[model samples]
Each structure stands twice: as C-alpha cells, then as structure tokens.
Target: MPKRSNYWLGAGLVFGAAFGFALKGIFIKSAYEYGIDTISLLSLRFLFSVPFYIFILSRKRIQEESHPQVPTITWLKLFAVGFVGYYVSAYFNLLGLNYITASLERILLFVYPTFVLILRAILLKKRITHLQWLALGITYLGIVLAFLKNFDAHQQKNIGLGAFWVILSGFTYAFYLISSDGLIAKLGTTRFTSWVIISALFPTLIHCYIENRLDIFNFPIPVYIISMSMAVFSTVLPTFMLSEGIKHVGSGNASIIASIGPIFTIFLATAFLGENIWLEQIIGTVFVLIGVFLISWKGKK
Candidate 1:
C-alpha cells in the first residue's frame, strides 16, 4: 500500500476507535442506573468481550501461520500491558463515571495525548514534531471550551477525586498506547490485541472474584444487554482498531486523532442522554475539526 493510503487508513481506524470509545460513557451510565458496581460491571464487560476475542485469536492462528512464535518475554510484557491498559485504565474510567458527568470524564480522559507526547519522547526518544505540538494545543483548547459549560461547578462531592480518577485512567492508558504501539507492529495487530485483552481478563476476573462481584447471572437483563454492547462495540472493536491504527499512523498521531472522542461523547450525550449543546461547544467543535485537519492533512512540511 502507498504511504498516503496507510496514513488515511490509520486516521480512519483511529477515528472509528474514538467513536466506539465515546459510546462507553453512555453505556456505563446506563448500566449504573441499575445499581451495578464498577467492578462487577467491568467484569461483565471483560467476560462478554472474551469469547469474541477467542474466536478472533483462533481464526488468526489458523490463517496466519507464517508469523514467528511470540517470545516468552513479549508475553510477559503483554500481561503487564493488559494490566495497565484494560484493568487499571478501564477500572478507573468507570469509577470516575460514578462521581462525574460523562462529558467531564471524557474531557479528563482525553488528556492522555499529552501524556503520550511526553512518554513517547522519553521512552522512544522521538522528538515531538511542531505539527503535533500545534495539534495538541488546539485540540486541548477545544476540549476545554467544549466542556467548560457542561461541567457544573456546584456538582455533588468528590468531583475532584473523579477528575483525578479519569486523569489517572488517561495516564495509565498512555503507557498502554506506547507499549502496544510497537508490539502491534511486531506481533500483528489481531494477535496482539486478542492476547492482551485476554490477559487483562485475568486481573479483572481476579479482582472481581476478590470483591465477590463475579455473579454475572444476577444482573438485570438491561445490564447484560448494555455490557454486551460495550464488549463488542466499544471494547473488542475499538481495541483492535486502535492497535491497527497505531501500526499504520504511529501512536502520537493516533492519540491526537482520538481527541475527537470527547467531542463525539458530548454529541452522543446530547442525542441519547438529553444533554444540551451550547454555542461555545459548537465553536469548540469547529476548532477540534481544524486540529484534526492539521493532523490529517498531507501537506505538512
């Protein structure tokens, strides 16, 4: 494939991943309405997601026999990756939803690109390009403008803690992105995504077991339905898309592209959750589009 094709393909995949992930805020809030705790809800999401991953892994193994067997050390890294990416990151993200509005949570979580910028520079020794700096600045400004009105200053207690949790979620996920960005290139996107998600399931299940939250059969049917939706649409699909996207466009660009997630979240919130869109948010959305255009445009010199 041509370089231009790869770039646009990667951009498109990351955009789709962002959209899929943006749906998660709505999914969690809906399930929470039925009184499911965060651990249990996460457990259900993992459980619902695993079988599909297994199917994918199995199919890939049979069809793509040419790739070398993965090293044991890499598997270890994958386990650690899974722990950070899925378990720690996901757990905190859902936890924050309990304390804050979905829009605010998305805003805080989207801050991960900043972390990604720093981590990539330190870990990979890659310089931050001027375009990325400009894109990040504009992207963040848009998020702030878009969210400023929606987040109530007078909201109930623990807003600070909630913001911290979601920020933690983003920070940990940046580590995941940096770690997986390289792995996905080496191990093949399908195999790496499936194994890491499967590995993450272990810690999630163990935590659920320790919490005595593994009783999946008792949730209301709506909770099960929502969890299944999250598993397929948000967790499984987006995870694969993101890894493949990183393979195509590299992690920093992917992260910036995904900053669109928060905007999508608010739009989805307005559509599904009856949230109102403000004029400032519309202006912010325009700025976000410009940032994205800067990232996606091919004429950067």
Candidate 2:
C-alpha cells in the first residue's frame, strides 16, 4: 500500500479497536452484576480467545512450512511485554471497574495516549513537538470535562483508589504500545499479537487458579454470553487491530486516535447501562474530536 493508504488503514483499525474496547467496559459491568469476580471474568475472556490464537499461530506456521527462527531473546521480550500490556494492565483495569462507572473507566484509559507520547519522548529520545503538547493538553482537558460529572456524583468510597488503578492501567498499556512498536514492525501484527496474547494467557490462568479457581462454567448464561463477546470482539479482534494500527500510524498517533474511545464508551454505557449523558460529556467529546483532528489533519493534507 502507498504511504497515505497505509496511514488511513491504520487509523481505521485503531478506531475500530477503540470501539471494540469501549464495549468491554459495558460487558464487564454487566458481568459484575451477576456476582462474577474480576479474575473469573478475565479467565473466561482468555479461555474463549486463546483457542483462536493458537489456531491462528498453528495455521500460519504450517503455511510457512517452517519460518525463519526468531531469536530466543526476542521471543522472551515479547512474552514480557505481553505480560505487562495484557495481563497486568488488564488486571488493574478489571479490578478498577469494580469501583467506577464504565464511562469513567473509558476516560481514564484514554489517558494512555498522553502516556505513550511522554514515554516516547523520555525513553526513545524523541523530540516533544509543540503541536503534540497542545494536542495533549486538549485531550486531557476533554477527559476532565468528560468525567467531571461522574466524579461529583460518585458516592463509592473507592473512587479514588479506582482512579489510581485505571491510571496505572493506562501507564502500563502505554509501555505495551511503546515496546510493541519494533516487534510489530518485525513480526507483523498478526503473528506478534497472536504470540503475545498467548503469552498473556498463561498469567491470567495462573492468577485465576490461585485467586479465583477456573469456574467460568459456573457463571450465569448472561455472564457467559457477555464474556464470550468480550473475548471475540474486545479481546481477539481489537488486539490485532491495535497491533496493526501501531504498525501503520506509529504509537503516538495511534494512541491519539484512541481518544475516541471515551466517546464511544460513554454512548454505549448510556444506552445499555442506563447511564445518563450530560452536556459536559458532549462538550468533552467535541474537544476530544478536535484534538484528534489536530493530530490527524496534517497527515491528510
């Protein structure tokens, strides 16, 4: 594909991934209503998704008839990255959701873009451009605007702790985006994502085993259905799309594109979860879109 086409493809993939992930919060909230715990829910998600990952890997391997051997170190690095990105980040996020609304969770997660930008600047020695700073400020302001009402109405005692957890979730995920960049370029998004998700599956299983037992089958039918949807739509599909998105857009722009996630999640939550949509969220969504436009506009021109 030409450079322009590649960029647009990446943007589309990221936006699609964001939409999928936005739905995750709703599924999680719904499952929680059935008394399903975080570890169990996560276990079910991976249980449903892991088989597909393995199938993809095996098929790709057979098709290549023995591909070039990856360095052992690189494989190990991929596992480690996946552990942080998927397992740890997801653990914190699911647990955080226990204490916060789905809409708040989405906005908190949206902060990852700023984290990605800052990580690139500090760790990779990338220059922090003035435009990026402006974009970052606008994006964060939108987030604050989006969540302010929830923050006020929140009667949950754990809201502060919940915010802390989701913020950590964003931070760890930023590291994933940063670390996965070179790997995605080298391994291709499909192969890299398949392996990493598989890698993350181990820890999830282990955690569930130690903390929550693998009783996913014991969940109510609604919980099972929601978990399956989370696995396919939110986990498997979005994971690959995000990997490919980073490949095309670079992590910084891809993360910025992800800011749309809050808007998506807010609407989804309002519709299905019976959450109210306030004027503040609308204003916030507008600002977030403007920030995205500011970041993406130059590329199209």
Instruction: Report the number of the highest-lDDT candidate.
Output: 2
Checking candidate 1 for backbone clashes, the offending pairs are none
TM-score of each: 0.82, 0.86
Candidate 2 residue lDDT tens string, 75-162: 9999999999989999999999999888878877766767877887899887767887787788778877876876777655588788
- What are the Cα lDDT values of the candidates? 0.81, 0.84
TM-score of 2: 0.86
Instruction: Note the clash tally of each candidate.
Output: 0, 0
Across 1-301, the per-residue lDDT of candidate 1 in tens digits comes to 4399999999999999999999999999889999999999999999999999999978887897576877888889988998999899999999999987776677667666567776877887968779877977886787677656656545436867887788889999989977886787778778877888888899998898888747768978999999999998999899889978978888668866886887889888778876566787677766666665565452233
Clashes of 2: 0
Off by over 4 Å in 1: 1-15, 123-153, 241-259, 280-301
- Candidate 1 overall lDDT versus native: 0.81
